[model samples]
Target: MFKEFKNFIMTGNVIDLAVAVILAGAVGLVVNGFVSDIMMPIVGHFAGGLDFADMKIVLDEAVVAADGTVTKPENAVMYGKWVNAIINLITVGFVLFMIVKAYNKTKTPPAPAAPAGPSDNDLLTEIRDLLKK
Candidate 1:
């Protein structure tokens, strides 16, 4: 069982999968950074300083007692965060798509197969024609 596990771990597919997973994690970090740090700010500027993270529908306003000691927290649906998440998802997908496209471009296409030689039947027909001539 130990040997079997070792063999499984040493397999090319397993190694490739491990590498792919690591690369995907790295790419995820890069994509997330790009979306949040770079893209969001630009988008916010374009959208008239609209901050998605702060966009929410307040269901219940916060209740405050005397001296603001006892208070009930606000309850609401935070749709702004959802919008940001959606943007993040789209950015990640687009970035992955571009990476795949670039990787495909780098790969060399398989060379075309050499043309096949004439068949035996064709050779025999030619021989027969030559004999007749």
Candidate 2:
């Protein structure tokens, strides 16, 4: 059982999958940074300095007591964050699509099949000549 487990862990497919998962995580972080740091700022600039992450709908206001000791936190729906997330998702998808398209362009096509051999008529002619000789 231990050997079987070891063999399973050592398989090429398993290693490749592990590497792919790690790479995907790294790529996700990079994409997230791109969206948050670069794209969101540009979007905000174009939208008249509107910050998407701060867009929210307040459902209930917070309650504060005289000493400010007894209080309730504000309840709100954060729709701006959702919008930012959607933009991030779109950007990541488009980038991945472009990457796959470029990769396909670089791939070499399969070699053409070998041409067919002599036809039946040609074979018959050769046989007839051999018989005559």
Candidate 3:
């Protein structure tokens, strides 16, 4: 069982899958950063300076005591954060799609196999007939 487990872990497919998962995680981080740090600011500038991360509906206002101590609210609709997440998802999807598209574009089909040459027997027969003639 130990050997079997070792073999499974050492298989090419498993290694490839591990590498793919790592790359995917890295890509997600990059996409998330690009969306949140770069794109969101530009979008905010255009959308009347609205910050998507701060957009929320207060279902219940926080309770404040007389001494300015506050209690956390029980519920709220954080629609702005949702919007930001949606934007991040869309951007990541688009980026991945473009990457796949570009990769496909650059890939060339395998060249067609060269036509088969005459067999040795056929060549030998032709030589014999030519010699007889």
TM-score for each model: 0.78, 0.79, 0.79
Runs off by more than 4 Å, candidate 2: 67-70, 118-133
List the global CA lDDT of all models: 0.93, 0.94, 0.94
Model 2, span 40-98: residue lDDT tens: 99999999999999999999988889998648988999999999999999988988889
lDDT of 1 by residue, 3-55 (tens): 99999999999999999999999999998889888998899999999888899
| Candidate 3: residue 5 lDDT (0-100) | 100
RMSD of each: 3.4, 3.5, 3.9
> Counting only residues 3 or more apart in sequence or on different chains, how many pairs clash (N, Cα, C under 3 Å) in candidate 2?
0
Model 1 lowest lDDT segment of ten? 62-71
Which residue segments of model 3 deviate by more than 4 Å?
A: 114-133
By descending lDDT, how would the candidates be arranged?
A: 2, 3, 1
Q: Which ten residues in a row have the lowest lDDT in candidate 3?
A: 67-76
Off by over 4 Å in 1: 118-133
